[model samples]
Target: MKHNALAIALTLLLSALLGLALWWDYRRNATPHPTPGPASFPIDTRSAARPAPAPTQALPHNGLYRCDGPAGTSYQSHPCTPGSRQGDVSGGTLSTVTVPPPRPLPPPVASVETPTPKVGLIARGPRPGEGNEALCAMHERDIKRIDEAARRGQSSESQEWLREQRRWHKDEMWRLACGR
Candidate 1:
């Protein structure tokens, strides 16, 4: 029982020491970062020098394609015949002749959706004399509205207008209610 306890204690100590050693090694080898100066705000590391690709003389499918015959090579759109020196070999690329890919059938067109009419819920603030309401209560109501508007991401203009309204009301409340 004593040996088992001692073994566990030793194992824990070894693990802690191993972690400490790894941390110390990392700290010792780490390169220090210098404080960025005003000039270092914008760093341009892009290499501006790169050679342009060599132009391919082969025009893609201007009714001309590479045709390889059993005897010799010829340029034609059709397959090679025994009497004629014209046959198309698929797969390998020829520099002088360009083969266009087979035309794909177009997808079916989608129908346009009819616009759904918007039903706006009218919001009317308290009357002028109701300004004696609790300061936090008014702000809480405004905050709820702003939070809901922001969550929905429906109307940024509405949020701005609410903010403006709040600002104007705050100024008025300060003057009249607070007697500032």
Candidate 2:
């Protein structure tokens, strides 16, 4: 009986020592110095700094289409118009001829001369009085001369004369119409 009591006391003492040692180890590990703050973990800031790529806009008829048939045959369709099939009907090999895509047209060149305004075959505006009739007649004659010069390809002389006639007519018409 005495031997059993001594053995139990030694066992209890050993268990208490083991428990105290385990508690000390846990406390040492749990209580941290220079406690964790915001920048504790090594964060890869580059990933956050990198901008996400812009989403691609899909054009018309861009997705894949599929078709199935008898005899355990299945086929994928391409971007084609209605009733146009990429594969053969009889399961034969298809001959593909890839046409070179059309090149974009260059932008139109800007011309120095203004385009003539076309208002069908009708008198442009109200006719001037008898006193200004000669000015009107002169304006018409100048226009005819300009047209003839342009038709004959006398561009420089025609442009110069046309500019002079335009300025003269504009000034005269404004004066006659407004009684200035």
Candidate 3:
């Protein structure tokens, strides 16, 4: 009764305050920020971008090692075993390999056959043709059969039939309007 009304009022007031806070936050973020000062820019970004080179350690070394064991063949950075052959890895880092820039595509070929425009005022819809009245009556009978088939649980077939009906309706309207 009265308590319910008071609870609803408090809830509405809380909602309004929350909405006001969101509006204030949106406005604060939406306002354009001042541009950074020149002093804020990094002095030597190129040097900073380059990573420190890895330290070299002395060891029994071979650039690449390939081992042909009784099980199978394997290749790694370790020194080759007594029975296996050693070889260098091609392209140092395979991931860093670059592709040549792509050639520019040729312009589209123009269409040779251009249709000539019809002369005088154009008809708003399909032009009237002979025997269209009989065709429209046949379409109406087909539509009634389709509706019955739809009631028998053939939904997909009925939907396709309905599309055909709409097409026929358009043709019928055009035929009746132009008296053909």
Error of 1 at 77 (Å): 61
Number of the top TM-score candidate: 2
CA lDDT of each candidate? 0.62, 0.61, 0.64
Q: Write the per-residue lDDT of candidate 1 for residues 106-171, one digit (tens) a residue.
A: 998999966655457544554554555677467557767656665665567877886787677567
Error of 2 at 83 (Å): 96
Better by lDDT, candidate 3 or 2:
3
Model 1: CA > 4 A from native: 33-39, 44-180
**Cα TM-score of candidate 2:** 0.22
Model 2, C-alpha of 155: deviation from truth (Å): 4.6
- Residue 25 lDDT in model 2? 97
Q: Could you tell me which 10 consecutive residues in candidate 3 have the lowest summed lDDT?
A: 53-62
Clashing pairs in 1: 80-86, 80-87
Clashes of 2: 0
lDDT (0-100) at residue 13 of candidate 1? 100
The prediction achieving the highest lDDT against the true structure is 3
